[model samples]
Target: MSERLNGIEAFVAAVEAGNFALAAQRLGLTRSAVGKSVARLEARLGTRLFHRTTRSQSLTEDGQAYYERCRRALAELDAADAALEAGRLTPSGRLRITMPEVLGRVLVAPLLLELGAQYPELSFDAAFNDRRVDLVEEGLDLAIRSGPLDDSTALAARPMGHQWMGMFASPAYLAARGRPASLEALLAQASAHRFVGYVRDSGRPPWQFRDAKGQAVAFTPSSQFDFGCNSLEIAAMAAMQGAGIARLPVWLVREALDQGRLVRVFEEPQAFGYAVHAVWPHARAMPLKTRVLIDLLVERLVPALAVR
Candidate 1:
């Protein structure tokens, strides 16, 4: 109905502006008119779209889901309008993307900013977090993720490149305890030293690694310190302060190594690596803007961040 469309528009505007009054102003309607429209929408849908208080207006869980879908719909409408207005216009739409925090910030964010500059009509919604998200359920257009993706009938993944892991420690720590030349020496010396490690899902430390030759090798951490955490940045910082040795991505510690703040422990047959991929839903045909965004990421981010 006309009322429903009006409500959807008002609700979507409210989410984007973060307030009902702003949405009303944007729509050229009284604040009460916008509020009533949204209320009628909630009544028709049998779910609340936002939590309104004197100080703030925030989306509820159902509201967030509805907002995502509505936003996408509005974006598609805008894209269609622009295409009609400007013949042969490059892809122009809102792209909803997700990625891990570190990679998102250091790698993808810049590429998106550049893409926005190139495509004047394009906009984006990007979420950065380490936790895995259900892209289809959450209405995300794309996700950049590292490591093996679980098989999903509804999702598709495109492999981008490999990420190499390395062990690093600060110079102060090395001077005090001395660096080991080989895996055996490293293991022998590690038993007396503190180590920062990954936290497993079961609330235990991640499994240590070893080479094929089983030389008590470079992958295994010493039994001396058992401190564990889920964040690689945290582990790296701990190592920088001589808290312990840390296994982390080369991209993450490159600056530290260059500045002589951290030293690579093992060089050959680099241990603990994972493949990075761009994942999206298989059910939906990727919009032109989303496809262009993915291509831009592949062209710009892969070479910049991939391990040499």
Candidate 2:
């Protein structure tokens, strides 16, 4: 266990320093020792973490994946030690955060409000928007992201939870254009029904489903509406207005579902190949306030977004 921990510590130090020599300086070891430790870790995992030659070095695919997890884990460990040493009950800091508009307002804001009451010294500078701001450029401290973080090399993220996308429409719309009894029916009469497109960084995401065996299938919405949106609540509103069928998070439409304003089609849970994450810049070690907030978010978000 100590050996593995040493290897991980060496690996993270090297990655953060962007080279073994600087990592050696930071870790108080020889460059050769740091390199050897990383190599040992790679051999144990049976996967190469880096591609290094005399002139160039870069993280391998496996390395990139592992590095993200390791960096966050190390930050949490460092933060726990700092918090214990600080020996303070009330956290005091101004946290700058960003999140999607609807989620920020509907789900996250309430939690923050409750947390504020817990630690009155803690304050927030938040931006609720669909636009993905550069956290570093904006000097943001934390962000709750709901999709792939392909461009997150400078960020350390922890999976908080995920929301399921299910097909739903206003009761009136379903009544007018008979309910899609199954996935096949939904696709077959494609021209008869319109769909609200979900715009993402990769472009408009298609409806995703899982077969009986739980293999994923992506179905592009052929018939469309006048609007495409990035906001869950807005897309749901379009469906509620009978503009089209929307594939949206169930939480956004739970009230509508209960009130019979909307009805879910095809009794199954589906995904758009993504999950939610709470992220902060990699350069900063987690502070006591940030750590507590992340803990609260994970504790609350998972159950709130759980598929029923």
* Best model per TM-score: 2
| TM-score of every candidate relative to the true structure | 0.64, 0.70
Clashing pairs in 1: none
Score each candidate by Cα lDDT.
0.75, 0.79
Q: What is the C-alpha RMSD of each candidate to the true structure, in Å?
A: 14.9, 9.5
C-alpha lDDT of residue 129 in model 2:
80
Candidate 2 has what TM-score?
Answer: 0.70
**Residue range with the least summed lDDT across 10 consecutive positions in model 1:** 215-224
Per-residue C-alpha lDDT of model 2 across residues 1-308, encoded as one tens digit per residue: 65676688889998889899998666645577778889889999999999999976889999999999998987898887777757867778899999988878898999899889999999998888877778878889989888766433345677777776788988888889889887888889878887886786657766778876788888887644456877777888888898878888877788899998889876764353357888786533467678888888888877788754
Judged by lDDT, which candidate is best? 2
